[model samples]
Target: MKISAAARFRRALLIGAAALASLAPLAPAQADGLPDPGFQIVQGQTALLVTDPQNDFLSPNGVAWGVVGKNVEANGTIGHIDQLFAAAKSSGMPVFISPHYYYPTDHGWRFEGALEALMHHIGMFDRKGQLTTEGFEGSGADWLAQYKHYINDGQTVVTSPHKVFGPETNDLVLQLRKRGISKVIIAGMSANLCTEAHMRELLEQGFEVMVVSDATAAAQLPGMDGYAAALANFRMIANHVADTGTVVGAIRANHHK
Candidate 1:
């Protein structure tokens, strides 16, 4: 009953698509005062925040696997994001994957005691330029490959942000601002932590934020409640809370306007 990596990815994507379809009907065909991509002078003004969809968070064998609970992994949400990517491509909106990249000697390794000990044991953070020893090209690299096909489509623009905190990337903020992006659609791993951080920061920076409920995950620990709780918390701060389909529908409707 073991699932292969490819199979897991496929399953997650399918689940996400199904979720998106269900929400399509609920979204309005048009909403007044909302920024519509169709009339917007700039193309790719809308940015899709694909946060930390890494193998370590998505793969069962990753270091934080059981600690954050099984739901934090990407296996369940990859497919949903794929559907969003399709919508973004059709709308000419820009997709950004905020990957968590760390060097062997990076200071990020010293944050959490457990993670540091594990990295030391695995020699991933060694000063001698040793790579991760957990196999399959490690989490970050593996996630990049898993989504390589999407990138090849030339619709999504990926960025590697090297910050321990989700909202700490100045480069990302600057890029979005430079592009005149006033709103952002977010989806990614560890909903309560990284996802929340990003949403808060984006809102604080004066960008309207939409959080895709089913497209994000949270720590798998008890009382986490996975997507449900994450969605509720996001609803409080974000401009809108919707599933992948609803967001895609909004984007499409706006694009066609």
Candidate 2:
């Protein structure tokens, strides 16, 4: 039987489509949509997100210490975040670190909001410009030493720096989407600010979020308890809120499938 040229073209198209479909699930969660609006985070479809694990937020000698030292110590945030990373690795889950940094140019803005102005004055999370690595080695912008193994390891991904409090200010959503992550297990510093902002924005973007409560801390001032305020919102907005132990157990249970 003689086949028409147009018929041969159609046959080629179908063959190409099937080949593409087979390559879609590169890292699991190959489907674009979430299982449901409310999601149960499993080993394959979710990532562990730790934000602003920078020295400025986690170290006692950091500039922001005067504000967060007590809370950070009391909450044991450093150790908890470390544990979360360890468990995520054990379960073979992808880990994403969202960092915060500002350059010299960031300080020169004429009109700044209260927190922005304050951060500039305090020199918090300050690293040299994108071109220079100065002050980044041991400065407040550096990651906590305890987490070096995890963050520096080739497997973990560090997303583009977030200038403001939310993931919208960075490539976080892009990285997550590309990796087929439909859910996030999140914990990090500054609960009321960065952590909460990430939660709010991720939820709005339709990613199910489970917060590790004790793995995050907030700066407490005389009038406001930052952690306290963030806790209320996390409980109400996040798909789930639990401690490191609980989340680690769940991750382990779901692993190796």
Candidate 3:
């Protein structure tokens, strides 16, 4: 007996639905996981520019210290940063270092109110101790001395951009563009505030951005999960969120080319 026309139509519809269901998983994956952006690798077309990886920002002795201060020093982000610097030097890729330094406050009561005031009130800030016209000096200067091997080895090019924010200072964006750098690898201290701001600006400017997860830190604010939140926001806006290992692999991959 021949099947009825209605039954054949129903069978076709069911098969079509089943096929669609089978493809549903792939649909989201395809939509979400596009091939790594062109800037994923450190070679050929991208530059590895670390933001404010200075003694003050990355070291406990720095004014804007973070929970990762000791960890960053111990885990060799300092050394890894140096290695990246060396790679850039060898490849002639521009390695920009945005160190944080401030001129002496010629005027007294420069920063009287706001968060600085609160930090001071809570003994978080000090004038002669933490705030001074010191750069690559004092105990904070130790890391720079240790990492000087990379500088002396001709493995790194360093530039200090003094601004309230790293990405905004010293025509950094312009310089990067001039060097034909379309992708920026960002890592540094206070991930939630400065790093987050930089990532937003970079994304807005249409440059592919990658935040090295392991190389950044956040303040241990009370009841504030600033670091994790910053990472989440960065992951959403950035071209990719990679750890130091992935970043290293990408850089090495570029070297082979």
Candidate 4:
């Protein structure tokens, strides 16, 4: 069986092309218009991670309402976050909360970022003391009234407060890892800051993160649309981004009540 020189040359070229193709790096998601890399809601392995679900962020009378209220109402963020809480609890999925608090001592810091300075000036999430409930009941640092039931439940894990935007300063990752949570369905207040930061960090920590878009809102300044910014980042960074209804449906479908 003798092969022609031309045929052998063509075969060599094909083999070389295939080898090169195998070595080529795949195009990034954004470069290819971003295909959806979906995530599954496995009951025990996946948990709901909500950040800064507090009075200051969600309540109409709280300190940050001036900047965050409009976006919150428009997105129904408060309600959506509650829905996620309900779904997670009913489905027996773990729920982890990452709250934010600023004590009197935090105000004494030498320097702070723009938002941190503003937060201190405005006294957002200011508690009486770390260990005292004195002025904490109705304060900005307290949990939103409606969410208290879910959050206060003995089963939910509330990690120490994240002083800044992300969970880096908190024990959230430790809590999640201890519970065997490798996939996180994330939601909560001030989307552009805490929510996005959590998504980025958890992804870096080797967890599959899916963001619940409508369940979080952000401060929309005159020139800064934080919610819009957060949405863009969520699409680019998270394994998937979905609405509250869609996420709740997934949770219910995947786990029995």
Instruction: Tell me the TM-score of each prediction against the true structure.
Output: 0.67, 0.83, 0.67, 0.88
Best by TM-score: 4
**CA lDDT of 225 in candidate 1?**
61
Q: lDDT at 146 for candidate 1?
A: 59
User: Considering TM-score, which of the candidate structures 3 and 4 is the better prediction for this target?
Assistant: 4
Pick by lDDT: 2 or 3, better one? 2
What range of 10 consecutive residues in model 4 has the weakest lDDT sum?
A: 23-32
| Model 3 clashing residue pairs (backbone) | 56-62, 86-155
Give candidate 3's TM-score.
0.67
Q: Is candidate 2 or candidate 4 better by lDDT?
A: 4
Q: Which candidate number maximizes lDDT? A: 4
Q: Tell me the tens digit of each residue's lDDT in model 2 across 1-257.
A: 99999999999999998876665554232153322123466655899999999888888878888898898888888989988899889878999999998988888788977777888898989877888887688789999988999989899989888877999989999999998998999999789999999999999999989899999999899999999999988877887788889888888777855
For residues 1-257, write the lDDT of model 3, one tens digit per residue.
89999999999999998987776564433355533333456454677766656565565566556554655655456666666666656666656655544333512345654544543443331223234544334444233565555444544445544345546655667766767778888876557766777777878887888887777776655686667788778766777777777776667667778
Model 2 CA deviation exceeding 4 Å by range: 1-39
The best-first sequence of candidates by lDDT reads 4, 2, 1, 3
Q: Which stretches of candidate 4 lie over 4 Å from their true place?
A: 1-32
lDDT of 1 by residue, 12-108 (tens): 9999989866766664334542322221223456678888767666666555556543554343566777778777777888777776655555644
Which residue pairs show backbone clashes in model 4? none
Instruction: Note the Cα lDDT for every prediction shown.
Output: 0.66, 0.86, 0.61, 0.90
TM-score of 4: 0.88
Clashes of each: 7, 0, 2, 0
